[model samples]
Target chain A: MLRFIISLWASKLCLFLFKHTGRERDDRPGILALRLCPNFLDRVKKPPLVVAVTGTNGKTTISNLVSNILNLEGKKVAYNTWGANYKAGQARCLLDAVSIFNRPTKDAAVVEVDELLSYKTLPWIQPNYVIVTNICRDSIRRNAHQDLIFSRINQGVSKLPNATLILNADDPNSSFLGENNNKRFFAIADQHADVFETNVSDFPVCPKCGTVPVFNYRHYRAIGNFYCPNCGLKSKTGDFIGTKLDFDKREMLVKEKDGEFKYPLVSDTIFNAFNIMAIITLFRTIGYSPEVIAEHIKHIKLPENRVACEDLGKIKMYTFSAKGQNVSAASTVFEYLAKEPSKKELILLLDEHYGDDPNIETITWLYETDFEYLNNENIKKIIVAGQRYLDYKLRLRLAGIPVEKTVCVFDEQTIPDYVSTDGIESIYVLHDVTTVLRAKKIKDKIKEKITNQ
Target chain B: MKIEVLYPELSNLYGDYYNAKYLAMCIPDSQTVFTSNNDKPAFLSEKVDIICMGSMSERNQEFAIKHLMPYKDKIKELVDNGTFFLATGNSFEIFGDHIEDDGKKIECLGAIDFYSKRQMNDRRNCFFLGDFQTEKGEDIKIVGHKSQFSFSHGKATEKPFISVEGGFGINLDSKNEGVHYKNFFGTYILGPFIMLNPQFLKYLLRSMNLNDSLLYEEEINNAYADRLKRLQREGTEFLMGAE
Candidate 1:
């Protein structure tokens, strides 16, 4: 008890001091707390209603949407606004939720938990609702494979047998979590399901027969309607189904167990469509009315760090984040950029950054990404900048991209000098999360060059 | 040149299939034949210049071993006769004596003198920088990454594919990495092993009696030089977790 009080009060003091001192990156409080008391999470006071949103991707957007809806409904809610999804970040989130006296002040808390770290976070959070967005291939250093991550989540969910699991029926890899527990599913009948193609596929085999299940409708790698020919293992239908998605119209019709209702599409990307579906399913399962949820969702926009667009007269530049070492995320961004009808030039800044972590960066994930999408004739010149620019160039060459079409620069700031604004309608600056601020500066430099041109 | 990929549908884990794709790009007029688990491998029936296989899940590894058990002698003959075979990640384990996971042993094709022990609780993730000596006695620096649940044991130092300068090889404490018996080369290091090492790819092409001119030779060499400098830098971490 004394340890709990000391850890909590000490962390609370750290948060206070950090906030006053303008230490915007305040994960130190949680780290300090954990250092002082290893099991501080188990002893910390939590809100009566806690929801943990977790998956390989889309956890942040889903958790944010859920928390936004709850806040709009006049419930005092606490969530991790900064991108801290791990155990230390989660500890900091909980500390911020409670009063200085260590009593919970919020009515509810929506926590975004990392998939690999879920086994550690879920047991302590003891959430009433566990919303899983989807499971896909992530970094090999962090997430070895989907099987390992699935097992980790399974270990976490096993502790909370009564917690309702909100799953993505579209993802076969994640849909089967907590098989015996109560599960509510959300699915989207992808309009562009058949057109998906990629080199890296984390396809799931049938659990019973050990056969690779054939997909009836494959939206992208390992996602869609699948059925095993050997064991008759089939994909599950969702309790909440999103249909008639019109990307241009920015509208979708959602059918729930209660009734069918029209909701405004939050984003045009297929993954964002799934994110909205997961958010809707969670809100509806937790007794939020459809009308109220839709109203709040209409105001929520995709975080600029994920994707942002700027129109510099006739030349449009888009800053798209292709997460480092994440194959699916990079592939999605590449495919999306390739589908755009405008003549494009690509400025790739997708190098893994060496932060405080001691591990050497792995470059194997580059082969899995769909760099072939950039081989289209519409793409004029590809400018790659960073220490690993040659690695990307080699992968692109193997993808059948012409040698003359690619330009390599060791210095990222010099990328603008090689970018060709002539005969191209727009330039796409594809960047890694670590290089977002650098991407913005590159975009600004390109904007200046265009204005001077 | 013909490159036959064995059980690509099953062994296509961790993006190691790109090694085969890259080899094809380096070799002119090369045709790739992808043989699924249900289909018989083309190498078993025909003359192929190279046979490639990537990684797979442990469960699928069992299925792969079961499917290939009948051709153990054939695999041995091909390896002895200098048929170039490249197996990346744990696919190389399928050619070993056995794989011991959690006290249970799954017998593999005993073509090699090694066995693999798997620990479900511990996964080894690290960067591998090694010295690879080519057939012409030219020494080349080979760099790649290893992320796996199991590591091979027993007599791996007999003819290792590469000498480990950094990171763990085969197991936690082995400086000798992988197997290099005759023309068969198997290793856990795969940064799409071929794509990352252009000089090694050239050596591979030269050994296969093809024109060793690599596509984008200058850019690839520059990239390799940069990577080598970074890997050799003091305090650059080669291991992630406990050694």
Candidate 2:
């Protein structure tokens, strides 16, 4: 116990030093604590209720939403808001809530865990509920493929005999995790939206019979209500179902066995709707009333770091944090842009910045992404900037975008100057996670230029 | 010409389907048939000018081996007959003798002498720059990325598709990268290998007796040259083994 306290204090001191030294507050402290005391996570007293949100995407947003809602309901919560989601970061979040005596002061903790790190994290945290938003193909170098991530998560969840899993029934890869475990599912009903198929799909064949699964309707990119024709295997009937998503009104209806509830749509995108639905199901399971969830959720806006819009006089500027090396996330942003009924100019800053490394290999994730969405007629001009700008230009041209409309800049700093702000109602800046600060700087320059004009 | 992409739905794990797409772009009139795992490969019935297969999950690799095992003789016959076969990433491992995952060993098609062994926790990733001798007696530079959990072992009877100039080859110790049996070209390199290496693609085109150049030849070649130069400077610094 004495050794554990000493390690905890040392971690706190490290964090204090990091803050004072103007360094980013990350998982380094938690890692240091673990190094000092290998069983630091086990030594600390866990919160009364620990909910872990994990998956390939939406983990950060879901974790944030759950934490925000719980806080609104007057419950103290600890979460990793900086998007540090590995085991060390999770340990840091837990340590943040505890006193020096090692007793947790918070009532609950909403932790965002990386899919692969679940095996290292879940055993120590012993979360009461593990919400897997959805699992899909992520970065080829990091994730490999969806199946490998699924297996890792499965191995982790198998060790959690006391936890119930919250899964996405629409995602076959993630829903498969619910097998042989106490699990509840959340699914979005057929929205009747146009399903534009991509060249690749993560789950085209049925896991059980190795046959092509028959889909009643596809939401997007192999996520849908699917059943195997050979073995009669189908998507599990979700306990919580989101239906009648009215994007114009920004609202969706959630139906449970007992009754139906309406919640303000978090974002226009279906992915965000799924995140909202998952959080609702979690809050409902935790004994929060439907009215409380609906009311509080409206106040919880989407994170500005990811998706934010600002009006600079007549021109509306939008910024989306498209994760570098993630095709699905980038595709989602493009899809959202395509649906907007306005003439727009796009600024693509999708390069994974490897600071001062000129020899860094060009990422292949660009080819996997569907740049065809940017070929929409409404997009008047595209300004692609950064290290991988040439690669982006080539991909965009292959996707059938006209060379005249596309402009390439080698450096991100010149993006604002390159963007043509003429005869366009809105300007969209799509930046990667690592280059968000640069995106903001570019946006400011554009805003300044537009204001002067 | 007819190009058959075997089990594309299962095998297109990386952006490797772009290889087939680029091939189609380069040869506008050619029809590319994407064969699903459930259906029999089109190469079984009709004449296929080229057959391509890409990366896939380890579990799906097992399924692929099982699905292709029955047609092993046909594949061997096709290879001997000098039909062009391009297998990228882990897809090439399916044609090998066997794959050992953890403690379980699954038998492959045995089209090659080597065997693959996968370590669940150890995934090796690297940027490769190499040269291969074409049938025209010209050596061309090949640049591609490799991210895999498994590595192949054992001596290959035939010449390798690409010689290791920078990164680790077939295994950590071997300089031979992949197998080239007649017209069958197999490599662990991913990233739409043909698209990244235009010179290699041109060699492939020459082998097919096509006079056509690559689509966006200038840009593709420029990218290839730039990548090759960077790889030369880095000198295996970007090459990372299992963690």
TM-score of chain B of each: 0.95, 0.94
lDDT of 1 at A50: 93
- Lowest-scoring 10 consecutive residues by lDDT in candidate 1 chain A? A352-361
Which segments of model 1 are wrong by more than 4 Å? A190-194, A354-360, A451-453, B134-136
TM-score of every candidate relative to the true structure: 0.95, 0.96
Q: Considering every candidate listed, which one attains the maximal TM-score?
A: 2
lDDT of 1 by residue, A1-453 (tens): 788889988999998999899984679999988888999888888998899999888787778777877888888987777668888888888887898777998999888898987887899989999998878888778887777788889999999988999999989889989977899998887576545577765764675566768878876667788899988988889999997788888889998778888888877777788888888888899887889888888888777877798988888888988886888888877777777689999888877663233344778888878888889888888998776766777777877889899897667878888888778899988887788898899999999999998
lDDT of each model, Cα atoms only?
Answer: 0.83, 0.83
User: Which residue runs of candidate 2 sit more than 4 Å off their true CA positions?
Assistant: A16-24, A354-356, B234-236, B241-243
Candidates' chain A TM-scores: 0.95, 0.96
What CA RMSD would you report for each candidate? 2.3, 1.9
Q: Against the true two-chain complex, what DockQ does each candidate achieve?
A: 0.52, 0.56
Q: Give one digit per residue, the lDDT tens place, for model 2 in A1-453.
A: 777888899988887787688764678989988888888877778899999888988888888888888888898998877777876887788887788778888999988888877777777778999999888867777787888788889988998888999998898889989567788888999988787667555785777767878889877777789999999989988898998799889999999987889999888888889988898888887778889999999989877878899997777999988787887787777777877778999988777753355656446777777788778889999998776666776787888999999998677777777767677899988887787888898999999888888
